[model samples]
Target: MAIDFVRSLRGHPVRPPASGIARRTSFWQRMHVDPWLLGMLLVLMCSGLAVLYSASGENVHVVTAQAIRFGVAWAVMLVLAQFSPATLMRWALPAYLAGLVMLVAVEILGDVGMGAQRWLVIPGVVRFQPSEMMKIAMPMMVAAWLSRHELPPNWRALAGCALLIALPVGLIARQPDLGTSLLVAAAAVFVILLAGLSWRFIGVMVALAGAALPLLWMNMHNYQRQRVLTFLDPESDPLGAGWNIIQSTTAIGSGGVWGKGWLEGTQSQLEFLPERHTDFIVAVLGEEFGLVGMLAFLLLYLLIVARGLWLAGAAQDTFGRLLGGGIMLTFFIYVFVNIGMVSGILPVVGVPLPLVSYGGTSSVTLMAGFGILMAVNAHRRLLPR
Candidate 1:
């Protein structure tokens, strides 16, 4: 099969008709499938199912539903991986525009769920988060726009890109979903950083952000501010606003070195921990599998990040490099923020642990981003110098 693929790439005609067609199709299907990336994802998915079962109190139905979501996401990943980087670039602006429009639709016609207006429901047909689409579109749009010019973009270009990022981020934040908004903004920033923006400008922006912290604090909703305060002192209101963080930290700390073992964790099974199957699933992992399991999960995550960076570096074009790199960095942020929040090191925001949390939208959206990364890698060799 490998020989046949090489021959096809070299413009050699195959003599065996049936075998040639079958092999050619198989090769093409497998072409964009990065072994390391796929392997890591598989491991994470299996581990997620195991932990989710335990987190949900050994509920087979919960794990079964999550498995279905993973199946759909995996199919979407493979299908998306078939597109060439050029094809993805062509759709970048339109995709971003579409996401923005959906976000607007969400603001006006979106359904409220669990105290947030983030999902758009199309009557009886479909319901989904528009912000999830921005996870990919935002970075792609920024990369596409930046690729049109020289690296170390001018102030004007930076400003324009910031506006592009700000629009959806502003809208999503108004949904009061600080987590998704931060993720979207970070993804765009990764593109800008990869595009070689000026360090002086970055420093100035950071300083301005620091200066505006007070104003930002003042503008935050009461619940949002309470989260920050709870992060600083979870003991201040241990049975009230701090219950989630306190319970999470206890679950993590009680696990000691080797964990309580599988479904034996008292905190999660007893319903002491909050969001055991979603945002705080890592705490369940920690309590059940201990520090060793957490370390192993981090290793797999790091390998995925490393492979993504390698692919981004190997890409032959600016768009591929920026888009691929941005996706990888944003993925890293997802892991870091989720782990930090679970361990009580950061304010609790509703960022789910990628691939390891029992959620449909986030899992699907993340897998699709990897699909784009695979597309970038698979098409790199086809590009001319």
Candidate 2:
């Protein structure tokens, strides 16, 4: 309901504060902390850690590693939250430029471990994905640029935004990471969407996308094409290209309404589901907690999205609205695409479940975004900077 209402007001100017009007800052706001969102994140982290334990087959080593990452990311989130939106906007371009450079560096000096050159290892320092940086930077860059202009940007502005988005998307896709590229693209696009891009134009773009499918298919790598084919008919390959989907769906279906019990799912515990700790972990969730467990996680995700949208709707300036909304929607896509792929409804693209999946850079990027959201909410009364 709030999302729809926000959509209806898309092109309208954000209600300007009454002359000299400002709400009294609460202790939480002054501290740049959103107690509500922080509480939600804490609950999510704990729940996800529990799920990760079961998903990793109760591997304390893996669980401990993920917890450490969560702690590091949590610190990063809180620290970023302390910066005002003006400070964040000031650093936006530099961050985006740095992200692009790192992406290029990834192509040049990045490591190769999982058949794709998407990681940059600082040799005993840290191994991370440069593309992850773009997840936050893309929105910041777009919002920074467009917030200077009027709403429902014209063709020239749209073209400029496209260039900004395409450069990184091209680089990341060249890294052969379809999932990350889609996410990076989504972040930039959400900014445009919220800035009031017209439905007619969106329809035209959708049609163009449809028309280009053949070309897109031709350009896809063999594995990428195979994933689409498997999505269409998993039974054809059942044990080969389709094993993941088949097993994952079975794991979910076998759980029925109440599930087999935590750490007790046959597909996960017996190693039948591929990537049980990462991409397909939602299946582990479904199989263990059943429909009820799956719905609980979904509810958590919905709460996050709703809270994020509320922040976006209440943002004092265009930059805050676009950046906060973009971040939230991108987070939404992370949850949707991961769960959709795991359930066999969408082609697998290797998107991990938001806070639930075990990964360092992903969690950091995600938390950093919420931190930005907090910054926007906390500093709403002050002028942008």
The residue-by-residue lDDT of candidate 1 on 1-385, one tens digit each, is: 4665678789997456564553233454466778878888998899899999999889999999999999999998998899999999999999999999999999999999989999998888778999999999999999999999878898788889989988999999999898899899999999999887677888998999899999988878889999999999999999999999999999998998899999999999999998999999999988988999889899999998999899888988899999999999999999999999989899998999999888888889999999999999888755432
- lDDT string for model 2 (125-169, tens) is 999999999999999999998988878898888888999999999
**Model 2 weakest 10-residue run by lDDT:** 1-10
The alpha-carbon lDDT assigned to residue 118 of candidate 1 equals: 93
Q: Scored by CA lDDT, what does every candidate get?
A: 0.90, 0.91
Which pairs, if any, clash in model 2? 86-385
Q: What is the lDDT of residue 198 in candidate 2?
A: 84
Misplaced by over 4 Å in model 1 are: 1-30
Q: Give the lDDT of residue 160 in candidate 2.
A: 86
